[model samples]
Target: MGRWEPDARGRLRAAAIELFSERGFDQTTVADIAERAGVTERTFFRHFADKREVLFEGSQVLQATVIEAIASAEPGTPPIETVAAAMQAGAGLLQGNRDYSRLRATAIAANPSLHERELLKLGRLAAAAAEALRDRGVAEPAASLAAQTGVTLFSVGFEKWLTDGAVDDFALHIRESLAELKALTGDA
Candidate 1:
């Protein structure tokens, strides 16, 4: 692959994940990723601030997708249900990338810093969901509770989706997790 090839950003992300998987996150460097991607260090910097950003670059898109779903949900929908649906909708963005997601997850899990960054990204998503709920006129505790719970559901569901070789639909995992939550709360 040439540095002038299309999808330099994608190539960089792929290279970063591959290097991270093969060499360990802490052992990998920007130069290594750039070399693997056949791009200059400047090109990598243009696409990502650091190696960690390669893994988290889609967080904003994920957050926006969830927020849009929440905001566009039918009026009068229950807060929890709205958030769950929003999360399920957000899951669509990850649908075709299970293998990539699995590798990314493994990389994050192996590094404490990456794990913390992942948690922070989830926290931001939750906060964004909460704000979207509030925009929908949901009350204080209800908005926060629903948003936090939705994020938890997404986290657990995503793990199940990653680990379950037979499951291919992320939305299904989210729905199952939501159902399990409802059952646990005696609301099912």
Candidate 2:
């Protein structure tokens, strides 16, 4: 409302989520999101590539967080442990964003195209993670397996955190998911 407003991207994102929840992702347009945020369509476009981009803008940052964590992990740490640490590191990005995350997840779940896009983003993240693991000198199958498995566990943890509403700690859920994975694979 002032000349010095902060977080225009956040405002646009919040408005987009609200509009999508009320009108459905397919029904919501970039113009609608901009109006709701009290910004112009140009402002919306400046922040997001399109309406769908609002929901996925954080994916790139999240992937970078995971990859950096993997790359910086101790030299001899097991691949899975490195992944769990990476998941934990990535979790910080979404911390205290539970409500926005829940709304985004709901919108993604209700749309087939959005769901496919989400899967593609996750796949890319997994690929990046695998490449990071290889940089750590992990062998082929082990690196690939650990990366995919980490993505799966991270996905499950995020779902639980977003949907439960009562869960206050996203990282804890991720760590718990990793523990379960380790237990299942007898790596615990």
Candidate 3:
């Protein structure tokens, strides 16, 4: 087919991740990602603001998924359980993207800036979660604590899922992680 084909966004994301993994995030350019994606620089820019954004484009969606999950929960749901439910709901985002997720994690881990960006994204998710919890009538430190705890659980679960090639279900990893967290706290 032609060079400027369909799935420009997906192509750009995949291309950016591959290039970032091979050449390092700082060394890789938007033009390089565009070329690797078989598209033009304009097409790349249309999909992502910069190479850094390629790694974080899903942050908003992930946050939104969690927030929506929290909002949809029963009014009487406890704070921690609300957070856990939201986390499990958001696991759908990573469902079939294990290889890509692993590559993205590796790419982010290798670069301080990328790692910072990831932390910032997680912070945003936590803040959004806290806000959602507050909307559910949860007060101050408890909301923040539950939200951060959920983020921690999700991060740990994602790492375990990436490292354990045998695990195919991302949600299962998250549920297991949540169970582990409860066990650790003697709440299980």
Best by TM-score: 1
Query: Which pairs of residues clash in candidate 2, taking residues 3 or more apart in a chain or in different chains?
Result: none
Per-residue lDDT of candidate 1, residues 52-129 (tens digit): 889998999999999999999999999999999999999999999999999999999999998998999999999999
lDDT of 2 by residue, 69-130 (tens): 99999889999899988988898899998988888999999999999999999999999999
Candidate 3 Cα deviation (angstroms), residue 27: 1.5
lDDT of 3 by residue, 1-188 (tens): 24547788888899899998899988999999989988989878777787888898889999999999999999898899899889988988988899999999999999998899899999999999999999988999999999999999899888888889697787788889988888899944
Per-candidate Cα lDDT values, in order, are 0.93, 0.89, 0.89
Model 3 residue 69 CA deviation in Å = 0.4
Error of 3 at 134 (Å): 0.6
- Candidate 2 stretches with Cα past 4 Å from truth are 1-5
Number of backbone-clashing residue pairs for each candidate, in the order shown:
0, 0, 0
Predicted structure 3, TM vs. truth: 0.94
Candidate 2 overall lDDT versus native: 0.89
Candidate 2 vs. true structure, TM-score: 0.94
Candidate 3 Cα misplacement greater than 4 A, ranges:
1-4
Best by lDDT: 1
